[model samples]
Target: MRTGAAATYDPFASYADPREPLFTSTVVSVIGNIGMGKSTCMKCLFVLRPLLLGRRVVVLDKKRQGAEGEYGPIARAMGTQPVRLVPGGGPGASCINLIDPRIGIATSSGAATSEGRPAGQLELVQRVIAEYLGHSLDVLGIEALRVALLAAPGRAAADSREPTLLDLIWCLQHPHDGQVRSLYDDSWTAADVYGWGREAAATLLVLANGELGGVIDGPTSPEVSVDHPAGLTVFDISSLPNSGPALGIVMLLIQTWLSGLLAQRSAARQQTILVVEEGWHVSSSASLGEMFREQAKLSRALGLCLVAGFHHPSDLPHGSPARALMKESSTLFLFGQSEEVEVRETLSIAQLPRELGDLIRSLPQGECVLVKAGADPEHVSIGISDWEAAVTNTDAQLTGDAYG
Candidate 1:
């Protein structure tokens, strides 16, 4: 973790000329192996340092420790608690509506559509359904879902509330002939539309009433808000199962909501950094990856910076969009990786020379290579205060008599 010389790295420091900037965007990718101090690096450098500068930090914490998320201690130290979301609505649970109109307007080509909802919202809902069904929806199925989404708001108007997944489901189960034919040709009948949408509706029915009930099927919980005065927000989704689409679905919902909320705050000129640990959950999926790619393009304009951490670039398949996204990061922090395949993949993605493979593999804990675009990579060690070391420690549970 030792370098020839020590210099401060500030991503926000500006140059005299606007045309020639130090970095293109604030997007960062931190890659390393498990237990290689990836989280520690992110906590100290991104979370702690950014908070000191009056910047907001939002974490989608997926790593569970004991009964809470790994970032719980950090949140509590900042005078806030992680927004722990539990399934089936318990004593302390948070919910986010899938179709909340507050999601701002989605434009086709710089112009707001007549639907008055973000186009991403429609894609989000469709992606959730596709996740549940284990495949993409067919043409008729996609049209049916679109028609149902368009009708959901009107259906919920009777109850004087915002549209929820339940309302969308109801609309799908009962397709309006006019709406169906309007989307397609006049030959499309209500029964035909109902058949096309029946499977998707049934899939959504299981999602709303099954094990994940109350998580996203109902109205958004008042407790859910991105603008916390303490300048730190953690969505504790650790309770979600790691193997299924549940985690990916919830991540998408949270990310979409964050985009909408941040879009509204564009005038405030507040800079926010969003951290997604175990980022492959978003990048591995084609749908989620596309959504995130679009969001990353807008990160600069929205006054937002995305800090995504992955165990290694090889976690994604070859030619994956995730790899492309990693290459586009303005800054990269690469930690020790023992496996040769992983080492080579990391180097290839970071565009580093193959000769550095031995150096990367031999990096000690709390040490990493800082790679910035248009600059030579620097070997740096992460130095933290005693208090930070105490707060960022993740080995307390394993510190007892066994090792001693």
Candidate 2:
């Protein structure tokens, strides 16, 4: 109440000048081995009251769904409902549920018939893959391609998995030619390539006409929580016998939509984040490469934000697309990674200068380093526990229980 001789005026009263620059908004990846809290970070970021966020958000979890309830607590804490859409096809079929009046759940592919398929979708995909193999066909010949396609990974390669189309395609494209000199002679490789190519072609024809599903981007509802909001989507690929067949289609739709959205804004810097988890399946798809290439080059102009989170970059076939994603990325968050090779690969990116490497490696779980491409990088570790409060009261239980 008392003013001294040199009292300073309140900064709030100085309305003429803005205190902060607009954040160059982004959609970035937070990667770690398994339980490093990537999903939790998302919950912390968007699972808030609608009032705080001028816009609503959408989240898609590829591996786990138990944590989904956090959305409810977060939404409720913010005086809003958390709407969750868990499509069918995993251990259970798709079902929609509402966490509260504010949050609604719409599950696509739930009770989806394996019979209904849009004509021409698969035919279009096979043509695309054939064109890609043509690139390697010119470089490595065919034998190496066949061996790569048929060969299995080190048992530790994945958590109880089989040879996926993307894995084979990646091998064909980025052959381990230098690593295995004795496996094939000139003629053997040629025959192998021919056989695998034919098989891939056949699979494409079958798959294109088969029972696969994809997410339709939505913010479709007119009323706030009553309809799909303009934000995020979870195109869960678990239901398919294998993710490889569906990868390209999912990426195609997402990228096409993102590119179109970006193009419409004549002179804006807004970014749409494509949070693609299990991106290995996507990157390996020969048909999806072109879409990714476009996003890496022009996403920001369209104000697009992209975040690719997968078990490891190695699963991504080779390096290029993931490398490109890393280069275009404004921020990268690495969580507790279990694989050493992938950890080293990410460390190479996350830890640039020699001095920063130690600090980066030593950081604990949940916390991550933020590197804004051209600027100096900084490490900020945030700690988070499971948002049980969100889940216990979620529509997820309703859906899961109903399915059970």
Candidate 3:
């Protein structure tokens, strides 16, 4: 089994043997409270073995602080502007083709097995519905999406042209059309089918053409593409209206795009990094969480590393995608948390000794407990250069704000 070295040197600075493998796999989970420097620590870790190993980094930056994003400066330092995904429908506003062929999608007959391999097109549509609705789809919704996903692709002239969410919505709303009518089994009438379609896919229809501003309902934007060099590409979705589940949807789409890109580049055998800040968004739902879990499970095979950041232990409870990731993580960083209950719970879930709860609660800024799969867990004060601190600090953008 080929394993990517976790760190070139001892990250805890214990002066241990340089040849010892600190961790295995490429998944790292950073758990901490707000202002505890989770991102800062991750920035330091990202530079260690991943960069030194010639891995490309792609960050799903959800925070929109400036024209760039949370990791904008770092991306710029590597010579690329963050891709701005904004709402309001104007020039400079970006759009993503959610069904882009490069994004992985399995056909109904070719679905991934229970072992968490990539899903087929039908499964991808079902997962998208779950993320969009922030819950599992009912029976009717699942069948509706499945039929649409299966039928629409066959209806398109070019096999390479993937069906859009709008096309699926249309399929649901108009099942009587010759193309989609055959999807209906002996189970229902035209009225029954149409009514179910309205109930099952109405929100998606609205998101595609109504309140969500069709950000995800079209062909690939010639203005925006994911073809970048082997460095960081940050998708800044902060400017989108914050009223709904836009962040989760955007993150899912980004992951899909990256998965497809990696699928195409598999022959290169180059390792890649995928960082999802505010990982709670992806962990909140079963489908989104499972999607992430499957990706982490397949990271080694895909030659990728996933770094997920979360603010609270509760963000990843039992059965959560984040919790599954925690269990499979090769490297773990736990920063300070003021809540005792949270500290204890984190330690318990992570299988650390109960006595460490106090230490976790009392940890100061820039310090954290580092746990590697193959190395002893230890507290490390992360050292950051002045430049790294400037770019990595989340509060740097808020320093000049004042109440009017």
Q: Best candidate, TM-score-wise?
A: 1
Q: lDDT-based ranking, best first?
A: 1, 3, 2
For 290-363, candidate 1 gives per-residue lDDT tens digits of 65677778887888787888886777876665776787888889999999989988888878899888888999
Can you write out model 2's per-residue Cα lDDT over 40-119, one digit (the tens) per residue? Answer: 55555433222134332333334434544333344344443333322322332332210111121111221212322222
How many steric overlaps does candidate 3 have? 3
Q: Model 1's lDDT to the true fold?
A: 0.77
lDDT digits (tens) for residues 1-404 of candidate 3: 11332333322222133554655556777888888988887766664335555566677676655554577666666666666676544565556755555454643343454523334545555666676676777777676665555555554435566567666676777665453446445556655666656755777765666534556776655424556653566777666554456656666677667776566455477666777776445433345566677887787677777788877777556776677777677677889998877787677777788877878888898888887776667777777777666667677567953111
Go through the candidates in order and give each one's C-alpha lDDT: 0.77, 0.41, 0.64
Highest lDDT, which number?
A: 1
What are the clashing pairs of model 3? 106-120, 106-121, 107-121
- Model 3: residue 111 alpha-carbon error in angstroms: 15
> What 10-residue stretch in candidate 3 is worst by lDDT?
1-10
Q: Show how many residue pairs clash in every candidate, following the order shown.
A: 0, 31, 3
In order of TM-score, best first, we have: 1, 3, 2
